[model samples]
Target: MAMHMAMEVDQADDPRLQAYTSIREKDLTSGHGARFIIEGKVTLETALRRGRFKLESLFLAASRLEPLADLLAEVPADVPVYVAPQDVMDTVVGFPMHRGVLACGIKGEIPFPANFLDADAKTGGPSTLLMLSGLSNHDNVGACFRNAAAFGADAVLMDGQCCDPLYRKAIRVSSGASLWLPYAHGGTGADMVHAAQAAGYEVWAMTPRAKAQTLGTLRVPEKLAILLGAEGPGLPDDLIAAATPVRIPMSSGFDSVNVATAGAITLAHVFGARESP
Candidate 1:
């Protein structure tokens, strides 16, 4: 077991505890340089186990520390662990931290779409990638990450307009899947599709148009890139035209499904359709 040197803080403004103050505002305007906040026990525990992100510090309610002692033992001695009463934590964060667990972590490097896809191809296992465009809603982004992880997608590629998967609420909603999954952000929808194509992936754009190939009938490729768009606008027509347009068969009355829901169904189908050697 690793030894822990936990420090106790009585005041919210203590310089060492600054990372816990006005967290929501700081998260929006000034994300901690290379670091981000990890909230709730599950998310923090996963980060500890993965060791992908380096833990900068930990702030917890003193009452909750006893139950988490074993987990805390895994923290490196050089890292600081701070404990405060729940009331003090609530005040420091400008909100009630019901979970009473929070940690500061620095994100590790993430690969670009082409590099990620290429690496997967080299691994010899079939590759599945999810591509997102203009997905500005954090909830949708989080759900997509959860679904991608659940359905065994190798990585996610998002346009510059997509919300950060590491956002606090997003990480919580994904059950920390965002931190574990490989994802790349930047480029437009079209750019991502072309990049996937250049990496030897067949791109499939999800849409509701009548003429699009239904998910059940389209041939699944060995290395596939499933493209999704924002809630209402959907993928641009030009992007759809540039790739194999696909639609999930549904009752005729509904125009479309939620982006995340559609992604889940599509990922399940593609993952299920992989051919055995």
Candidate 2:
């Protein structure tokens, strides 16, 4: 058992504590461990009161915190409660986390794409899928998954260029959707596109280039997978030309929408069509 230190606020914002904060925050959804949170509190009493977050430990300012007899009784005898001065806590965390309550929990695992497909295979097959290509931004990847889940896509597949869906920032940015939605990371975009087509899907590449067919007019098939590229450079020309291009109609002058936003709209369209026919 690590020796628990309970002191005053003198050490708040210490560099050591800040590093721990960053690690704990980033490790929440990582498979290495579980969900961990640091709750800031003005005093130990306040820290004890906000028990809903399931605090694993309490860090407080020794000088400012007034030891609560009742709260101490409730905590496990072995749980170490550390108290430091307000400044100490601030110094440790790199900022003023006056609340002084921090806890870590084990985050649940996200389901594999194969498992999701196995379960859903019997139900009219998957109608909509999101195929990501070279999306590096963790926030964007998570956002895309969140959109896919919201818009009724059946699965999300990540290519080699995409970030890990289980990343900590991705998990939170996805509002925990990362854990709930079925996702897989494998294969090149072209390889997955070929596989999807082989599986009876009409692969549609979402792009802004004018040569592509308008999204509204495409004869959407029963099963569809929307392929999206990263920001800036857009989908590789080869992939775009190889896929049946589907362009979302925006104001004639506007360029394009955010990749995730466009993905949501495209998914809604595909699922909407599935509903009609």
Candidate 3:
């Protein structure tokens, strides 16, 4: 591969490098439609290779650039790749410089839930989707996406209340699966269930309620949407009432599991069941 040169940043405040400055604060204040940061070598590589989001710029610790030459070569020439000394990068990002890799990319428009579901139908195969409601923890959101990808879920649908899966921490935790997987954020939990039903999916609400069907015994459908909610609240009563509630059976004492864990178990079961005769 031909060598590509990245612009060097001697000063942290260069106007062209503003997106990498004080990243945490910028991420919080910046609206969802704006550019978001990607951190770590793996995450950066996935974003560049996936080509889902448009790359805006890359900021790397000057010392790490040589080791990342091949990956940097994959970047488009027109996109700015900025290399800064370790101390300067620390100053710009307002954090201790460690992993030494970061990139910024514009947020692409998310497809509507109905459109995403319809597109899966057009594929003419079994479909699985994960729907999240009021899941505020970035870690859980990211882990859920990772699990979705692992268990063959076609897409993830998040209600407006769920944390952004693109949040830097979430993206990192997901090992960049958030970028690779298709997702949409909008509407109420009830709306998501209804949309899945309209798309011919058997919407299964995951909860620990006594009335819920045990996951081990329930028959999985060809097209299934598994609904999960925040850790403590689980699914709303109305949302639970709207769909068939399913639970992971446990020993007598344990009543619940983390939402992401529950999602993984449920997804694995459903995906496996769909494969059986």
* Candidates by TM-score, descending order: 3, 1, 2
User: Each model's TM-score, in the order given?
Assistant: 0.92, 0.64, 0.95
Which stretches in model 1 have alpha-carbon errors above 4 Å? 1-4, 28-32, 108-111, 115-123, 275-277
Better of 2 and 3 by TM-score: 3
User: Best TM-score goes to which candidate?
Assistant: 3
Tens-place lDDT digits, model 2, residues 193-222: 776676667889999988889988978777
RMSD of 2: 7.5
RMSD of each: 2.2, 7.5, 1.7
> Candidate 2 — number of clashing residue pairs?
47
- Runs of candidate 2 exceeding 4 Å displacement: 1-21, 24-126
RMSD of 1: 2.2
Better of 1 and 3 by TM-score: 3
Tens-digit lDDT track of model 1 for 1-277:
3324778888888899887788888763123355678898999888888736678899999887889989998887778999999889999999998989999877655555656555655445578889999998979999999999999998889987887888887888888998888888776777788889988789999999999999989878878899999999999998999999999998869869999999999999887777433
How many collisions between residues are there in candidate 3? 0
TM-score of 1: 0.92
